[model samples]
Target chain A: MVNHSKKSINQYAGYIYLLPGLAWIFFVFAIPIIQLIGMSIRQGPVGQEILGFDNFIFTFRDPLFIKAITNNIKLLVIVPILIILSLIFSTFLYERIKGWQIYQTIIFIPVILAVAAMGIVFSQILQLKGLLNETLRVLRLNFLIQDWLGNQGLALGSVVGVIVWKELGFGTILFLARLMSVDKELYEAARIDGASGFQLMIHITIPQLIHIIEFYAVLLIVTAFSFVFDYILILTNGGPNNQTIVGEFFVYKYGFIYNRFNIASSVAIVYLLVGIVLMILRYQIVKRIDS
Target chain B: MKKIALSRIMKQIIMITMVVIALVPIYYVFVTMFKSPDEYLFNKWGLPLELSLENFKRLMEGETIFRWLINSLIISGFSVLISILVASMMGFAIARFDFPGKSALFVAVTSLLVLSPAVLVIPLFKSMVKLGLINTYYSAIIIYTGIMLPISTYLLTNFFKSIHNDIIDAALIDGCSLFQIYYRIMIPLSMPAIVTAALTNWLYVWNEILIGLIFLQSDKMRTLMPGLSLFKGKYTTNIPLTMAGVAVAIIPTFVIYLMGQRYFVKGLTEGAVK
Candidate 1:
């Protein structure tokens, strides 16, 4: 009984200690989400009188909204493909192979550089007069040279490729770390049992990586949604006629550029909901797999 | 013996090809930084036949790149320092003390890990405006602190939990105050994790552009990312000079990462594992 009382007292004190962090979150995160939802429901210009649901309706009806949603869906599709590629690369590198560290370091260098720097470098590299086209010309494949970033269809793909190159190393490193942690005995046992390398990987290594995979999947989803700033903004600015505008860029444009706070808030709220759902789905998947 | 040697050579060739593909762009940027505009346009990938410091000199002397660099340093430095201090204190408190609602607080803090800055930019802008902090260094610093605190605290909390309670108890028995124990013992014990967190946070703050772009409007306050955009207008087609700017921006972080590779790798892998 005395121990229980002490535990209760400690629990109370824990709440008190937690007050600052909790309050900050409530103010910064919870309250902003609430305000976003509120703003979404109300229609007005910046600092104007609230008109119910008008801004949301405007946002929903806007052609750019659909474009943004479709672009985001495309990104969602593309990101997982890169993640799979990273997994394969990571597994290959994790074999304690010669020069593994050098490869790892080289691959990860792009990630260490700022995305803004990446955008500048890639833009120059892919420009019409840039190295890529110049290389084609030098090879006497002049007919093959084209304006890579200028083409509407090609521009989005180019940006996505940059995103993959920028992100893959980090993902590979993450998976490699997890792979290293898996007990070598499992691999050795499988090998002793006459399991092939592929079979061992499928049955043992992949299964062991389920948790880390889910964690990274959630992270990738969040990053895909929020972190395409330099590529999209710099490469295309959601253009070749708004063909590459993701939701976050849309929100930024609406809020800051168009000064449509209501619409921006609505988009933000929708993004928040989508993010929460994705996270919850990931959690459920992980839980089910763990169980 | 010939067959085995041939296979080894083939593997080396493949590895070299992969390394070349990865390093080409990095090399391209670095080489271009030292080349004249004519050399850059004519031989985009070649080693500079006549190396020049003119691009670097021009960037430093003409453009506001230096100012932007200083601004980035100040904002990222202060923000990282404040984050470490606040996060360590909170992490130590949670790890050592048996307190109320601890689990709930932990959950709340960790949940912020899922919340991205893109979602918070507008609302944060509003808050900053209301607080009269727009276009101020304080706005950038506070936002960085607020957003970063949760993750840093989570990392440090995990680190603190790994430490044995016996040492802390002994310190308490010796009549050491909580702050002293934290400063003298916990901090030293968790130095690796602390350093890792600091370095990670520093890289993040240094690289972050979206928030910096929105919160800071003044030419003087603009960071490397936004400030570099100005060069695009002036140079218009000068890829080499722009590449120079990129090289300059990346070198500091690269050096820092190289210096702290062990802590960085350990911290990243260990934090994720936990």
Candidate 2:
């Protein structure tokens, strides 16, 4: 009975120890999210307002808002495909082949570089007078060369390509790590049962990676909105007439550059809502998968 | 023998192709950084026409590159240090002690794993302004600590839980205080996770652009990412100089990872496995 009481007291002390971290998160994170939602509903000017839903109404009615949503949707589609490709690449490299470490190191280099640097390098490569165009011209394939980052239709795609190049390394590393943890006995058993290479991957490896895939999918989507700053700012500046405008960039432009705080706040609220919903969905999916 | 030779050849080919594709842009950056404006334009994809240090000279002479580099190091270093210290403590308490609201706290921190900092930027900015922390290094460090703490804590908690409780109990019985056990026993035992968390958070803080751009307006206070943008503006057409700036920013992280590759790989895979 005395030992049980001591155990309970220690457990209670554990909760006390957690207070500082809890308080820090609540102040720095949770409160701000609440503030964003509150500010979105309240409105006056850049620093003053108490109007309700007007900001949301104004933001939704704006044409750029629609464009940002659509562009984000396009990214949502493109990034997952790239992630799948990365998974395929990771699996190929995970075969305990010779020089696998060297491959992993090389692939991960791009992930270490700053995004601003990537933007500048990719911009130069995709320039009208850039190396990519030069290569195409040399190959007598000038038709394949267009102003990759200049054309409105292709600008977002160009940014997406750079993003894929930059991110594929990290994704490959992550998936490869997860893949290594999977028991090799499963693969050997499948082989003993006469399963082919393709069949083993489809039947054993892919299903096992489903939880990780879902986790990474949600991570990529959230990052797609938050982390595209370097791409937008450096590559196109959300331009050739807002063709590459994403919601996060929209918030930045309005809030920082144009001083449209009310509208930016509303947009942020919308973004937060979308992020929360997607995350909850991912959580549910992962929970179901785990069980 | 023929099949073995073929397999060896196949592996070489695939590895080489992947390496070349990966290294092309990096090579482009390094090669251009050593070339003059004329060479950069003429031999855009080739070796430098004539080796020159003019771009690097100009970059150093004209800009606050060194200052930004120092600022980035300070911010990343301090932010990562504080985050690890605080996160490890929180993690230890949660893992070792069965406490009320432990599950709730765990869920709260874990949920933050999915919360994007982008969505929080505006409100955070407002909060910073209200706190009179705008345009200050303190703001950046504080915000970074907050952002990183949750995930690091979560990772460390997972790591700490994996450690045998019997060892901790032994230490306690042997007259080690709670803090002593945490510092001497728990932390040393969990070094791999701690190192990995520190490295990951360091990279995030170093490569971070969004918060730095918003919170830091002065040229001297700007980190590498924002500073690199200024390099772009000045050398708008000069690929080589821009690449040099990029090279400078990338080398430290690369070297660090290489030096600690064994621990880095082990930590990442171990932490991620669960």
Query: Which prediction has the highest lDDT against the true structure?
Result: 2
Best by TM-score: 2
Q: What is each predicted model's overall lDDT from 0 to 1?
A: 0.77, 0.79
In candidate 1 chain B, where is summed lDDT lowest over 10 consecutive residues? Answer: B264-273
lDDT tens digits, residue span B151-186, model 1: 788789989998987887788668775668788999
Q: Write the per-residue lDDT of candidate 2 for residues A55-74, one digit (tens) a residue.
A: 77777888999999888888
Location of the lowest summed lDDT over 10 successive residues in candidate 2 chain A: A1-10
Query: Best candidate per DockQ, number?
Result: 2
